[model samples]
Target chain A: NSKVIQTPRYLVKGQGQKAKMRCIPEKGHPVVFWYQQNKNNEFKFLINFQNQEVLQQIDMTEKRFSAECPSNSPCSLEIQSSEAGDSALYLCASSLPTGRQDTQYFGPGTRLLVL
Target chain B: AQSVTQPDARVTVSEGASLQLRCKYSYSGTPYLFWYVQYPRQGLQLLLKYYSGDPVVQGVNGFEAEFSKSNSSFHLRKASVHWSDSAVYFCALNSNAKLTFGKGTKLSVKS
Candidate 1:
């Protein structure tokens, strides 16, 4: 069983519709990361947060993608307007902030399909 | 930038046969390597990781990986393979607190 949990294992949305996914990180973990895996098996690091504060993120996240990890709440990633190109597996991972031993644990992921 | 390369995109082997998956990485600083396996429609599971310690590290399900700093390689090995072991294997490198994964290699185990 995975400690990291992502809701809505599969999602289908129309183009221009909003899509969102939620994740619950492992207990005592302060760092949360979001990655996008495309059909070609390319893993793209989207964003990461440390206790509700954004640590690192890519340029793509700044435009249409938004994410938040609030205290005592499940973290979420939202896309303002869904696009066909946005169809992919959205993975959530959590890890300790410890410098050298930051082994991340991943969730099953939410597979999104935009029509 | 740190990058991981899985030379072989696909590998085929028979059950009970010894298996090896090659991984090469490029990084200017000290390297931290990890191997993760992804079953069909499942989340990635950590097979093993390599830090600053022993060159050979043991993992779950009879999986083991050897870290070679000289060659910039971290290869995964298993003594005997099972059909259940067939899955996509990814090699990753930690760079600036984030993991950079390879294109992944698909393993096919024939009965």
Candidate 2:
């Protein structure tokens, strides 16, 4: 079974409300990635971290999304003000640095509904 | 920029029948290919990945994918699929430490 864990399998928020979810990556994995899956099943890359350092992120992430992976705490992604368009499945994945390509393992994900 | 395209939006196949899902990608440099399967209300599970070596790579549950640099295609295949294989399959390209995913192909297996 995958070890990556995500809290609150489902979340609901009204427009302009703040929404947050957490993730604990698999043991020993240093790379964490966040992705958004819309109802159409289209995936959008949100952000990624390499051992608590931001590696790459999209523009929308800078505006309303805030994420952090502290040393001893679970990584969290928070939307400052939720919009109806923000309703989607948020997936978290972790990968170990392998010298070669790092294969990412994913958690079950958190489904968010913005009303 | 790297992008992936899964031409077929949905595919249906009978149990015990062969299966194939086509994927095409666009990238300037060498590409890393991966196949991921997402069950209902769940995150994606990695089916297989291709970094280097042989063009064909095998994954769990009898799943396999072939990488064709010439055609810029990476297609998933299974000799005989089980009904439990019903799910959405995504084809992704890894570049610059990020993954660009295709829209995904929804597979429905019939008994």
Candidate closest to the true structure, highest TM-score: 1
True contacts kept of each: 0.53, 0.55
lDDT for position B73 in model 1: 96
Query: Residue-wise lDDT of candidate 2 within A1-115, one digit each (tens)?
Result: 5799998899999999999999999999998999998998788889999899998889973489999999999999999999999999999999986533778889999999999
lDDT measured at residue A70 in model 2 versus the true structure, 0 to 100: 97
Off by over 4 Å in 2: A98-100
TM-score of chain B of each: 0.98, 0.98
Cα lDDT over the full model 2: 0.92
What are the per-residue Cα lDDT tens digits for candidate 2 across B5-48? 99999999999999999999999988888999999888889999
Compute the DockQ of candidate 1: 0.68
lDDT of 1 at A49: 94
lDDT, residue A83, model 1: 95
